[model samples]
Target: MVATGKKLSLDLRVIELHTQTKLAGYIKLLQNNMRKLFFGSKINGVMALYC
Candidate 1:
């Protein structure tokens, strides 16, 4: 029973780390998308000026 408890604790730690990594990746993706959207709108506005 003690061994099982130890294994469960280790598994929880691994899961926590994985979740953090995933969350970080998701945040980065959102930042990148926002940057792209900001720049895209700027470019569109410039094109509209010419059109």
Candidate 2:
């Protein structure tokens, strides 16, 4: 019984780790997209001013 419990705990830990990794990947993607959007907007604004 104790061995089974330990196995279950390990499985849960692996699942948690995978979930954390996936969430981190998504966060990084979102951050990159946001950075691009802000940078593009700034460039566009500058171009409009120059025109």
Candidate 3:
């Protein structure tokens, strides 16, 4: 019974780690897209001002 419990706990931990990694990857992608959008808007504004 103890061994089974331990195995279950390990499985849960692995699943948690996988979920966290996936979430982190998605967050990084969102941050990168946001950064690009921010810079793009700034560049557009500058161009508009110059024109």
lDDT of 2 by residue, 1-51 (tens): 999999999999999999999999999999999999999999999999999
Tens-place lDDT per residue, model 3, 1-51, is 999999999999999999999999999999999999999999999999999
The global Cα lDDT (0 to 1) of model 2 is 1.00
The superposed Cα distance between candidate 1 and the true structure at residue 29, in angstroms, equals 0.6
- lDDT values, one for every candidate: 0.99, 1.00, 1.00
lDDT of 1 at 36: 100
Which residue runs does candidate 2 get wrong by more than 4 Å?
none
The TM-score between candidate 3 and the true structure equals 0.88
The per-residue C-alpha lDDT of model 1 at residue 40 equals 100
RMSD of each: 1.2, 0.9, 0.9
Provide the global lDDT of candidate 3 against the true structure.
1.00
- Per-residue lDDT over 1-51 for candidate 1, one digit per residue giving the tens place of the 0 to 100 score: 999999999999999999999999999999999999999999999999999
On TM-score, the candidate that comes out on top is 2
